[model samples]
Target: MTFEIAFVLLSLLGMVIALILDKMRPGMVLFSVVVLFLCAGILTPKEMLEGFSNKGMITVAMLFLVSEGVRQSGALGQVIKKLLPEGKTTVFKAQFRMLPSIAFISAFLNNTPVVVIFAPIIKRWAQSVHLPATKFLIPLSYVTILGGICTLIGTSTNLVVHGMILEAGYEGFTMFELGKVGIFIAIAGIIYLFLFSKKLLPDARPDTAVPDEEVEDGEKLHRVEAVLGARFPGINKTLADFNFQRHYGAEVKEIKTRNGQRFVTNLNQIVLREGDTLVVMADDTFIPTWGESSVFMMLANGKDTEPVPGKKKRWFALILLILMIVGATVGELPVTKEMFPNIKLDMFFFVCVTTIIMAWTKIFPARKYTKYISWDILITIACAFAISKAMVNSGVADGVAHYIIGLSHNYGPHVLLAILFVITNLFTELITNNAAAALAFPLALALSQQLGVDPTPFFVVICMAASASFSTPIGYQTNLIVQGIGNYKFMDFVRIGLPLNIITFLISVFLIPLIWPF
Candidate 1:
């Protein structure tokens, strides 16, 4: 009822709108909120900037680098090629084999990279075997998410939460601590995908085995092709300069340079050049306009070709990635810890070293490899920490926690634990997993203080629930990656994921108290 409270609520509402619209990136949205609060004198400058220094933020950045190293080393690609079946396998057997393996790999590697490396391969294999790619992609993304919950270093979400816990003066999670619930969740998930997924999953598009080269044939939108001519005013200009929506009312889907560089059209700063091919989605009205423009040499009707990394670069990238994983594991051991107390062998350290080494080795030509890293994701994570700090410092999280405990007063600890698991899981589905953990963490601490019990079990629940992002594709980056490549509709994920979500929720509720003992 207080005006200040109302303002904070309004600010949070703004954040929700931003997330739903998704027109602006999450980082920009969170950052805008921070600035609004700061201007309102709700948060100090120190508080606004504090997230930048948080261990959680740093760990996420490091994980991205480590993932890049693995990607550059070509380790993931090789593994996918080896593990994926070639032909003549039953759909059930293939799903069982592929989902679990991908899940396990995602436990250590970044889930996004795992999906990216495997998506095309799975698509190709699905075509060759006369199976639907849609059937497997959602399962692939879901299983990886399930597997990421299994280890301390499995996903950046865990590390971020662990770092936040350490900052709260509690000892952070140990390696495999989450495995208590995570393993069961993974098992349950694998079971759901293996047994019921085929029945529930939609085969929206038949297995046409459209080669990466032939993705154009399946294009549903109106296609406009523009050839870059020498006098093209747009040449060397970024897409932003073209004012694409203003000038053509058409969205650029893909850009292909003469050199074979190809990518989704959202890349804003890529300079347009002569003799380049642009795959644009527009109405027929714009085609004549595009033809009249001097910027383009000609218009064509076809899908853009997929860019293939060099064979030598792919192999080297794979080897280097394997080395990063092995090295990070070795570096994190008790012996290694004792040898170098000052140097922590965490995701950040591993990623930094691996990125540097991969760049030096020119595994994927360091320059291009650098571009592969999702800078937006890193910024989003850092801003998420700031928002979390704001929530805690503003006493909002504690107030929410008090309200929750008041409601659960007569419900007992088991009921309270289940409630916490459900709340965390729902939050994770709505927001970034790391953001979910950050928001829930302060509540966990507050609840423990009120209940006069150990906070370990509560923290464990948050970690497990935060990483259980199975209900929606948009909730997790890996899911989005697979959704596009697998050509799956939104409901395909929910059909298979809803059961796995329930399974994980039940498993976490039962196991947390027994394992960590609140």
Candidate 2:
């Protein structure tokens, strides 16, 4: 093989290693690889940094703000309270009523916030009805993922791919174009979850426990605990060397030394001895994975948990979210576009206003709610665009596209569409959803160019397939959110999600060509 090919292959291998290890955040891993490529003269500095400026990156950042605003408004709380039937109800009926609405709402908003809003509500409702939450939570996340495919702004992954396609010199997707196939895939997914999820999903629910004594207000320190295990990448590292705060959303609060020195405050230079304790303050979603790696012991009580918003804040947050959606939809129209040319009514504008309004209102307390946004996710998506640009500029995407076209030499567009769907879906399972789309978008454009056909069908397929992350919780944020809240084992997701994944894949592969023929 040529040296360039060998270099690309090696760089890609390193990326895979970083993904599996997950010691550093995914965005940092991608950035590190990009820098390495630039130093090796494989990619230009501009190419390495281009993703930060991509429209997709900006849109994603704005969407986070918008989601935050809605979450702060308390809109979702009201929806949950109304949908969650009181008194005794069968698991099937309760799920049918709630899951579809959640899915539909997710099709318009971010799925992570949707899951966050619903997880506890579902849990409480399940308790009230005497049913295991396990029966509904996995399906809840799965449906949101499926529904995210229906609109451009629904997920950052879709917008990132859209920007990459635009950069590739093809026409980008319209707001509703993906809906043609997305709707069908969502329906198929919902049907699969409704009919089969109950039988296949596990019944792992956390046992109720007595409440612990409250910490003294003055004596309490801002702290979090994380258990480390064999799977952790930083097993032998020290606190001084480990850049936890820079990478993950954490700050080291205190450490218990191996010599049983409890609450060691001056641990900056201390080595992380095995079986040592680490007190940290960060988002709880990330704590569980630390235990899988044997990095430390477990979190202190209340380490990986967030309190549900009170009644007043919940109502305010929910109303603001609805208004933002209505405003964005109205603002995007041709009439509004013409009237508000200078105002520029796009995802960024909508999210900014919504965030500002929510923050000003103190609906969920500006300081606390600000921390809820996943900044790492935004950075990962931004870096994904740059990696995609590198892939296209390096001619790697074209080479892969050529191989695909060559394989289906005599086949029709239907076969070509199926190939694209499978490729995008498989890539998403392995990497970040946005990264997968970024990598796939260029190939989709190249294939359409080679075939002398319209690119919309190919683009549509990539968007839907990228968001159809049903096989693994690790693949999508929503999956992870529900996994912890539901107390689900890994295999439970596989049992229910594997079938939904297949159903969405089949529907996309067959229906996309028919709806938007090449």
Candidate 3:
């Protein structure tokens, strides 16, 4: 095998293993692989570095800041609080009441913040109304994801694919262009959840859900999970001996071992191992104190409950978000170029202006702006661009495309689109969605080029497949967020999300060809 081909295969294998094992973050793993390609001379420095300055990747970053500003504004939370049904309700009634509005918000705004703002509120609402919180949590995440697929700025993955299309010298998606198919998928998805979710999803959440532990006086406990690392000093020590509570200001709720059995009954006598996972009850102070500590490498579900923003600030933030969305959507029309050629009235222009305004206005904690942006994701995306370039440079994309084509040679582009959807969806389930999109883009593009068709359809399928990450918690961040709070088992995702995944796959394969064509 050629050195380039060997390197690419090895890099891909390593990524698959890394993402599956989850020993390292997907962004770090992808970046590390790109660095290897750079060292082997498989790719030039410029090619490897293209992702750093990628318009899509940077746009994602700016959106993060914008989302943080919105989150801090507390406007989304208040809106959701108002929209939730009053008094007790049936599962279908609750879903019918909220999913459409949730989807609308998700279609225009970032899904992560929407979930973050809404999940707890929904959970509390469910509890007060004598409903199962679990029924709503997963649905909340899924609806946001469904909504995100509708607009360009709705999800980072959409923006990443949009960025790639522009770089390939094609006309990128306008703000509402994706909504053409996306709206249909969103409608299909919400309808699917509404009709079948009660039967499909689990109605699980502890009837006596533990309250947050007091860090100081009068602070309630919040249940959280922390995975142990080698850096933890009390590896073999019992919690009682280690004084875990005294040291961390948290109480152990349960101890799940590497062997998979949880010891919620007698955790004090159990010896902590490097890989043992601890379910603890902590207060807000725990995050700032031990969140970065090496002792627990993966800490989750310690959400802070801040008071909502004042009416004036909330209105200002809401107005800013509306302006950002309106400006971007309106600018995509023919009138923009003829009337405002001098102005760069694209999503990029509006996002930049909105980000700056939010920053100057201190909508979020200005000093902690860096904390909101997932630098690892940005790094992974930047590195993914290089990885895609490497695949193209090494002829890996064409080779893979040809091999698949040989098997499906008798089949038309629809079959190819199905296979592409399945492949991208698999990659997404194994790795990050952005990483999956980056890897799939080149192959999808090559497949279209070889078939003598427009690459637009392939691009649409890639977007559809990459974001249809419903099979596993690892497939999407939103899944993990809900998994932690909902007390979901691995099978919970498989049972519920698998069908959603299949539904999306079907929708993409059937609609992309009809809409964009081969």
Model 1 agreement with the true structure over 1-518: per-residue lDDT tens digits: 45555676688777777666554556677778878878877788887776678776676665666666666555676777678777698889888678778888888777866775677677777777888877887787788888899987788778877777777788777667788788988888888788898889877563222222323556345655555544456666788787666766767776665433565735677776544556666655665555434444345433212224667766666666567667666876789999999988854576677667766876545555444555555666666666666676677777777888888899767777778788878877876676677667777888887888898988888888888877776677667555544545667667778778788878888888888876
**Per-residue alpha-carbon lDDT of candidate 3 for residues 1-518, written as tens digits (9 for 90 to 100):** 57788789888888879877766666778988898898889888888888888888888899988887877787887888888889867989989989999999888777776876687777778878988888888888888888888888888888989988988889999998788888888899889889887887787657234565565677677887776754677877898889888888888888766533467787789987655667788877776677545566456663435347798888898899999999998988898878998987899999999999999998977777877787778888888888888888888999999999999999888999999989989999887898899889999999999999999989988888888887776677677666655666677778888988888988878887888867
* Model 3 stretches astray by more than 4 angstroms: 207-248, 255-279, 283-304
RMSD of 1: 8.7
Better by lDDT, candidate 2 or 1: 1
Q: After superposition, how far is residue 55 of candidate 3 from its true place, in Å?
A: 0.9
lDDT agreement with native, every candidate: 0.70, 0.70, 0.81
User: How many times do residue backbones clash in model 1?
Assistant: 10
* lDDT, candidate 1, at 448: 82
| TM-score: model 1 vs. ground truth | 0.78
Instruction: Indicate which candidate wins on lDDT.
Output: 3
The number of clashing residue pairs in model 3 is 4
Question: Deviation in angstroms for 414 in model 3?
Answer: 1.1
lDDT string, candidate 2, 1-518, tens digits: 45655666677678877775555667778878777777777778787777778777777776766676665555666777788888988878988888789878887778866776677667767877789988988888888887788877888878887777767677666666678878888887788777887789876555323222234553333345443422345555776677767755677666544333444456667765433445565543454544322233233334223335677776666666667667766776889989878886765566677777767876545665545555667677767766666666667777777888889899967788888888888878766787678667778887888889988888888888888788876777667555545556667767777777788878887787778777
Model 2 CA deviation exceeding 4 Å by range: 204-320, 338-343, 363-370
